[model samples]
Target: MKFARSLAIGVVSALALSAPAMAQDDASSSGPTTNWTGPYIGGSLGYTWQPNTDREKNERIGFDTNNDGNFGDTVSTIGGANAFSPGFCRGFAKGGSAADGCRGDRDGKVGWAVHAGYDMQMGSLVVGGVIEGGRSLVSNSVSGFSTTPAAYVMTRKLDWNAAARLRAGFAVPTGTLIYATGGVAYGKFENAFNTTNTFNTFTESNRKEHDWGWVAGGGVEQKVSDNFSIGVLYKYTRFNPNDYRVTAGQGTPPSLTNPFVITPSGSTTFARTNDRFVTQDVRVTASFRF
Candidate 1:
């Protein structure tokens, strides 16, 4: 967040300083300069995607194999009979369970946002702040069991999001303004988790929440008329982490390699997950300049 703030300040300051030089250049030209000072409202359409994170952090977003109140059942799977599992996951079987793995993906989707901002134009330089918001239509679901014989799965949706940021641009000889933007962002999300051993299967659906973070990026805007403009903007928004609570019952899955082999008794387990949301967006915007 602090990095975002510093970047915005630096960009705006740089643009403001260049205004004097731009004005000096304008004095030597005879052609009429494009006007860009004013308040404007706009809407945008875009595509959004989320990048995958490190497995260590992702492993933290796990479910409990045992049904007790303890959430220490890490997300690693047990592939073979000799696979080692610490704590309650000891002697856990992995294969033969309905679940094959534990994972999730942040899919891409079509999205849009509305924006309102006031720009201060000085010769060929423009600087301003904008507040805009919209939601991405991406969804992800991961369900599978580790060889540890523990089965687990869950789903999440990156719903509505918004941001307020600073924008700076260099207006060329034509009516086009190439700009850069960065600032703070916020988002709302929905999540659900379900997993269990052969003896215990648990489901936790319907959890909606929100988080705060930052956004940064840029684009180009072109004015076709004094009162209307069209542009494309690209941005990356990062949201704080989200978590959910779940429970798993104990079960002793029979070994596939040896039917006579019995793992152990399943215990009551408690679990929680820490998952963050990040998105990349490419948007085409239409604005009404007042």
Candidate 2:
């Protein structure tokens, strides 16, 4: 996060310093004015941050203790109380005991995208639309610790994403365009599960999904020539929640005498709190205008 902040400050500073020089050049140049109307293709490389990666809550662990097909029956201790009193954590578990804690949180990673758009200049204002596709390596996970002295880990990753947006901005005589953009986005997510509970047979399902969401951001583009431009953009994206399930199969011998038998014999299904996957990106872009 600190690196992202520093990069942003440096880019804004560079743009600030260059604006004056660009304005001076515009004032002295005897050349034709730069036109903002055009079709363009571009690509961007950036660092992505998943700010909520470690924010996990309301995680549930269930079992079907009875031979019946329902998991609503809570797994209870020999004394007839909930067996998950050890609670949950936001990382992978190292061992069966709660005292072992969990592994450290995962970090954000690099992301890249390719885009195409067209712009129309009306007086000093430019309006346009763009489409983009990209991918990121960001991942997150959560773990539930049970009194059985076991850890159940659930993980999710952002696979890929695409967006279509409308852009509107003011173009100065100095060849700089300042713009704001917002639009609909789509993405895919991959999920997986792990556990330290060796006594129970686990079945995992609903491990991947395609979801819809939205994105919004703004950037400054500086035209280096009639056919080329460079810019930096900051965008925030979010996706609808998804579901994943893990079932503890019937214990050996199909009896309560089996420690692995979940009293209800049902699956434990959960979605991230608020069912939202969110990310922020800072990218440096280069474009070819036609």
Candidate 1 ranges with C-alpha deviation above 4 Å: 1-33, 53-106, 146-150, 196-206, 249-274
Deviating ranges (above 4 Å) for candidate 2: 30-33, 53-74, 253-274
Please state the error at residue 237 of candidate 2 in Å.
Answer: 0.8
lDDT of all predictions:
0.61, 0.76
Give each prediction's root-mean-square deviation over alpha carbons: 9.0, 3.1
Best by lDDT: 2
| lDDT per residue (tens digit) for residues 56-140 in model 2 | 4444344455555444555666577667678776667777777887785565688999999999999999999999998986877
Q: Report the CA-based lDDT of candidate 2 relative to the real structure.
A: 0.76
